[model samples]
Target: MSLFKKTLIKKNYKYKLLDDGISKEDISKAKNVLNSKQITMASQTRKFEETFAKKMGVKHALMVNSGSSANLLAIFAAGNPLRKNKLKKGDEVIIPVLCWSTSLWPLVQFGLKPVFIDIDPNTLNVNEDDLIKKINSRTKCIFLVNVHGNSCDLFKIRKIAKKKKIILIEDNCESLGSKLKNKHLGTFGDFGTFSFFYSHQITSGEGGMIVCNNDNDYEILFALRSHGWLGGTRFYPRRLKSYNYYAKKYPSLDPRYIFVNSGFNLRPTDIQAAIGLNQFKRLNKLILNRKQNRKLIIETLKKDRRWENQFQFIEPSKNINPSWMGLPIIIAKKYKKQKMKFLSYLDAKGIETRPIISGAFTNQPATKLYNLNPTKRKFNSAQSVQELGFLIGLHQNKISKDNLNLIKDSFLNIEKI
Candidate 1:
């Protein structure tokens, strides 16, 4: 290739999406924190927490080290002895099969049975019909996956959870900045979690937050976050009574050091908080750019002469204004078995791709080893999604004409491959 072609390819190649859209302002905030040297989880963390809670419209937000930890906290907090109506061992939690491993594992790690739910082919989220049918007396909660920044009719899901008295946990890891009917995705559930991992809606390198509406739940989560300590509120009379009767006797020992509940050390650094807050300020811009890039890619391919119903774009469901993180392409049935060749071709062409959130997770080797698939639940849509669906980055920067053409040409090569 000539030097000109090399430069063009370098400029036109679809790069990995920016997980952290850090403007000059975000870096300045981090530099200020670094210069101050109060660098663990302090002032910036608190500010980020307040701003996040207010933005998400939740009563409280607890920043954690990672989204996976946020999930673990949410699951374990539900089962905490301090919680009045806690999820007991053997109770069932409904989760979509087309989900990330962490979302499903947390329920099982907490000793709650995970009832697998299939996703809608069109939406790539939990099917409402399947969800309603699966709700039984033993059902204690439903852990929903707002897949790749898109969600189902969360209002309907919330109504069902309320009617059944089941806990609603929104695994909003991929769907940050997304809104359903004008409400944020995470705020509808009893507990909603967000991730700041690289390539997600926003990145802090590795960080997460959990949101809830109840004061008691907030207190439990705060205690659960760091060695179960009630440092901030132990001076209160009520918490003292619940602790050892000797809390008063140990007054000189700093009532602030009071241990109140089960806990873990899942706190983000001040630096991550600074960066995350900066990205949060510009979240709308990131969401809009990614959405536009996604449209351009789709339009480029669909307009090509080689376009022949080769793939289907997973459409957002009703009332879902998506903040897409990546573009998921579902190959048509005739080309389903040719998935490997097509993806391999794309990969060879330097177009990065990945499976759609580890697809039909029940089909995983570990699940089979545990004999979790014997009941033979029909997950045809999830199965099809597994076989056909693959994703590529929807970058923050605008897709140029040449890059868009490259994507279109590569995608249309489905015929030749």
Candidate 2:
């Protein structure tokens, strides 16, 4: 390595949320796309979407600019005019209190009322029972976030959703390679979303995918992902019957420019797709490395004499073989007051940390600004999570002895702080 590169690595050796997110091979794939001069959402994106769909065990996959855009497309498609069963204004969508902002915002943006259900403190996912209880006649959808690679009985939830005829969308952004009962986490819902953000399971710098099984849903998503045109650019061929129908119906309109539905420009570039596909080819290895690193960190801390139950690690839920996004740690109640100080100490020590999914979405000021919770009902479990939980990076490679020691020493200092 060059001196500058070596120095840069040395400077970040203490701890980082990500370590060289893109591999040399990933960059090479992106470079090839750039050299081809066809870097738009074309063949590379389609190829990645196809491989992703087959690997995910889904019928279709659509690439977008980011996971947020994936969620937005899923929401808008679920409520699209062409959809047989659609959500409308004032319809209720069930979501976990401990969720990412984008997971909740799309519902609100679609004019759907969000019914926030508390998460299980252990799994950091929606409590299956609480979620079921919150479902009512108005509950048209359930937007579940498989938090930090852990999920709450998705089979049970899927059954309930099917029985109630409710749309189920899984925000599996943080758990792309994870599985429950040998099936991928994202495949159990009507729609599943995944992210390829810098710190996620795989990195393409910034990209995401939405997947579904229904043919009509795939068509809806295809049109909505672009500018609602029946035919995409010459590079993106449309074989769907709807394109033909629209083309024949509007004889005067150019077949290449037939507009059929409301949409957004959420397409991912070929460069991002090339990088994402390259990373995805090694997803299983990445997942395994992260799992091993997590195990090593937890074992190191617990075996340490200084370990006095100062922290709690989130274990994967039953039947889940997780691909963790990060190592989520919940401080003991005694150190709850010192959590902020401990985080600051870690930061100063060159150990990075973040809140667990921004801590209960309802606690955010934006929720208050939108008057989402008029009743002021509290979610105590979510509140406790907000107070106690934080996350550290789980690198794509095995933890080094020095890095392991750094984490162990810095984390155990919680007691002293």
Candidate 3:
């Protein structure tokens, strides 16, 4: 009776957003950490921080419990009193309306006003012209999200921010190995944050890292990441000028227990660090496989006779070598109304899917509750993406022809849904 029944029964097709991302070596690394009984934030975390920093070409990299926590730390550190160029209350931060929730919340929670900008629908990233137009004297920071492994012209953005003396923090959670003109995406900012959560470029069950090039900023980040306690860094002990001064100044107080600044408990467990470090070693391979799979899937769909321009695939920005997490597809205007039903059909056939980063975060109920968008005005580009966009995973392993065929068949049959 159902149109999908025959295809479903004949092929027995099923696809997932990820294919066992954690390898045996990853599990063994975590297991060894667990067996050591020193499962807290200890040696493994320190080693991972060192290796991550060197690989990213940053002076320091601190591990955190999650990417959300990394964002929280970065925002709070930028506004910290000890920092030379700190953001103050009422400062305006320009952000894309098409970003993750945590990316925007940290700005608001830190007492900064957010000015929303529309995205470039083609690249699915912020439009440089619109972003620059929004900057004014009140603007103190630029909180940019590299949306789905793609970036706006960050080279130009960095130039503008430097001229205006505005702080730049990059949320590189969705893009781990992505590079622009050979330089990593996250390394271009005052602070660059990464996530190693399951289904990302790497998996540690849950983990994240933050990188900075400046010694002073790195020290402040190190202190802020772990309850504001200063002078415990193994990465660069030579740079902590206040370590001896504070120790000798306060003879009565325990020098080890010095609290130089305000902070939160965002340290990751050693097990997570071990797992993340192991997976991180193979990052190049993972990026390559995902890139290949993405190319294969797009080629498969376009080469199919059923292809009638029913959907549009987002391409990387110029000079960007992308490390894709998933294949983002936009339904053509004619198939827009059928989006939900088509997704449901894909699900029934055992194909998993998700909306494009929760669909125009500005339109969410929480945004209304907080009165984030006081104008209640809709962002045209973000709204278009919300209505027409969805993503399917491009796994770390090679996709079989059957899997590719299943995706092509299900996607082309939007009319049936």
Candidate 4:
């Protein structure tokens, strides 16, 4: 089959990976922003940022174009020359193997060395012991990923970071509504990022938010989100100093266009922010629905006649209250080779599926092009996930009986494979 022909003939599944991500209410909110004709980062965006910061218990939040941009901004801000304790070139940064490409790319883009750490397969997060062993005096930062709404012991990881004086940046994009113990997963580090993508806990079509507690970091993020322009929160007298001081010093230069630091234009539109804010109001409800749907699917599968422990499901990590993005299932070792065949059968039967976060990042072709893992070091745990794991969506709405039956039937097709 020709590539174009194949694309045209791709399976049309009855159950989609994500249902109508934007609701009527969400559209109404977005329409209001559109009708106002004030779409570019305005009052709506600022309001969303304030509400997000309050809910996440962070001092400040900056909305961005996408989760990838959020990651880029966080790492760039960390390495920016304007920061007092910024990372320099060739500094080592530790990250998990089971992470998204954007999580690792920013470190490489900034000339920082990335040290790969394996994940604990059970928790689907970084292996703390291995992470600790990889840390040395050269390590300047820890860009940890909270995988699939689960996290490693973030409290212990925070303590380790504190002891080592390393900057902690949590890629909490997949785990936004998740909590570790009583504290939220994203709030455990110097910088934490969240995604409001189509399949996340909340959806805004395409958007992301970065949060920080320190006033200086917040100011840096705000400026960086724009074109490095100086004035963001001029309401505060203290914040006006950068503009005032520079205006006085330069005399001729316009304070409005002062490019104080290196930056990127990663701002989210007001329409996206409006939709995200409306969805944010239903976040708790969405989280609960997904959790219940996951339980129902697991129970329904177990009750079926085909139930023979053909798959293993990932459980929430200790001291964590998860907000699942999907139902991650690992095929039995005996069925690993036939995984693709089973997945195809599921698709043919009108059930949709996806790989677990693009499997292990090191195994990707882009990693080789960038020479990310130069030593070709093996990540056994991560590799196992690549070989054995696949996921099906757990919707934010309760699973209907028809959909539940379809899921059970499709999953049980593994027996034939």
Candidate 5:
């Protein structure tokens, strides 16, 4: 066994937000790419994009350096000059308050306005009724964050977006491999984004992908992912239908280097692609392991003699087959004030924890800095979640008895803390 594996085993009782998600095979694949020495966004990235598209039932997938980049690309592509229906400055985008910063930043960065809505703390997703009610003529888009592996009824949202001709972007970064009615969570919107960041469903250290069905959208994204070059990298050529037309239009310029759109250099390296693809192939196993581990942790805690409904766990939404990112727990209202103390206790016990997606993003100081909420509209449910909820690692492996005992003993000490 490797020294790393031996050390990890020796410290198995100490819990973290993530275990070593990268495996030996994943490392070997990356090493092979390094040996090739052509480690830019090349063949491996293209292969991973193709495989991800096919398996996720999408028409196209473009890889980027990170999930934040994926979201940025999706937003910019939606508003690109090449598209017929493009978003413009001041257009409203409805998003849940319980979202990561990137999910909101992309919209703001693209000169669009974000309309924050409340989330259903039970499901840890947007309140579908609230979202539907907020959609007005000024609302041009809906950016949904499938938080921590749970999603709202995407079918209903899709139907509404179609009727309104509004763009939809799904941030499935935290919920990859999850499904609603047998369809993947990220496949329901006009543009879906996924992350392969550490502790996500799969990891490549830092990588992400964006998907779309329209050929035009894909072309726009393809160009935007690079420096808006018509011809992609030498190893992976983008033969857009407009290539010939652009070549003829710009006779003086090199056809292979035609600049066609506003863009960013968000391409993922071949090393990231290699490692991400290796982990992608085993995504189902990883999802299953997380599911089982979550079950074991919760069951172990609930069956203990100290169990007294001191905490509540979020469950999968209706018709949703979740791919859990972590084990999210909400302290009972009676013990709400003790949440931080309990978390510190867990930390001292060698168990790591984090808030549930930055605890109602509007409360973040950055949001105040940007004056995102001038009206001071309160999201009571979201605030409740922020006060009561926190999460711990749900590893991509079975839970050991020692670890389970540690979690149970530490978590049940909420009252004492």
Candidate 6:
């Protein structure tokens, strides 16, 4: 190597967990949106929503401010008066222990009790067997989470949800662009949500989308996404004379200020929509790079001379073709107690990492307040993952050989560390 190149590499080598897929074009689009002065939720947002719905083969797509908001809107829409399979308060929803805080909290916020299920250590998702065991007379919903790029057996879960007449909402923030049996990950549920968070599959900086197959559900979601005003909904701009449809039939009151149902303003800005659309056009390419980087990292580690059976990588569950958001790996059981130190060591060596989706939601203090871990039956799989698991970033661009070797050398030192 040239002296100049060697110096540059020595001074500038750093590895982050992940980065957003942004380019000059995404920035240009955002600038155009700002210049148009329609920076609020308007045409751009609607265009992106339509494009997203078509890509996912869903009947309706509603753009939201964030993934958390998307989940919130979906849960609220499930209880809306206009929705056919509505959820009532105290209805039970099954959720996995290995979950993000917002995914499980949405159920509680919507007045549904969450029945905790354990994740399969091999898949890092809710186990199908455990999920079936948790179901009973009160299981009105299944709020499933598709972890990172991997997923649970969504088809079976969907069939079960259908046969039991239960609502299905997928927290698909991490698994966007993924598919099962030719169907997109989020499309199987009544509502599937996607996040455009900083390091997610694709990014608009911060935004989300909700997709559903029912027009009525879309109408309800549209109403709930705004201020309960059916402003842009089909039921809105009522031609009738009265606010209430039934009252309008009787010609009794003004229809201009009608309040159709409950709602919240979770709309995204046109700027975000413009950027998201730009990034989304290249989603297939981004998925490929992430997959390549993951394979490279594993191969590099295993090929190192100091390598031992120090870690285990989890694959996407059966039938899932994942568009992974990151590389999740678990340390061997014997090294479990040293996980905290090991992660710190990696971080100090310039490789950033994160927990495996806030590990065992039941272990969080928020769940503890409700005594959510009833029966006290130990979640062995969840605990095993918690003590052993962590994730690293997978970039949209191919990783450098030097970066790969650095990670290999650092990880190979796991035993000594």
Q: How many clashes show up per model?
A: 0, 0, 0, 0, 0, 1
Q: What global local distance difference test value does model 6 have?
A: 0.83
Q: Any residue pairs clashing in model 3, and if so which?
A: none
Per-residue lDDT of candidate 6, residues 1-417 (tens digit): 231233233423278766536888999999999998878888788888878989888988889999999999989988887777789999988888888988988788878888888888998888776787788999998888889877777778788889999898999999999998778998888999999998899988899999998877877877778777656433222222223554556454344445577888888888999999988889999999999999999998887777787988988778888899989999988888778878777766877778888988788888878777777657889888888899888999999988898889889888888
lDDT (0 to 1) per candidate:
0.82, 0.89, 0.86, 0.85, 0.90, 0.83
lDDT of 3 by residue, 1-417 (tens): 363444445433378777778888888998898898888788889889899999988888989999998999899999989899999988999888998899999988988998888899998889777788888999899999888899988898999999989999999999999999988999988999998887888888899999988887877887887778865543322336677887888888777778788988898999999999998889999999999999999998899898899889999998999998788899999988878778778878778777887778889898988899998878898899999999998898899888998898988888778
Residues 172-225 of candidate 2 have per-residue lDDT tens digits of 999999999999999998899998888999989999999999999999999898
Residue 414 error, candidate 4, Å: 1.1
Q: What lDDT score is found at residue 299 in candidate 2?
A: 97
In model 6, the clashing pairs are 17-393
Worst 10 residues of 6 by lDDT: 234-243
Q: lDDT-based ranking, best first?
A: 5, 2, 3, 4, 6, 1
Segments in model 1 whose C-alpha atoms lie over 4 Å from true places: 1-14, 17-21, 232-253, 369-371, 374-378
Point out the higher-scoring one by lDDT: 3 or 6: 3
Best by lDDT: 5
TM-score of 3: 0.94
lDDT of 1 by residue, 309-393 (tens): 8989988888888999889988888887778878767766767777899999998888876666688677888998998899988
Off by over 4 Å in 4: 1-12, 232-241
RMSD of 6: 5.6
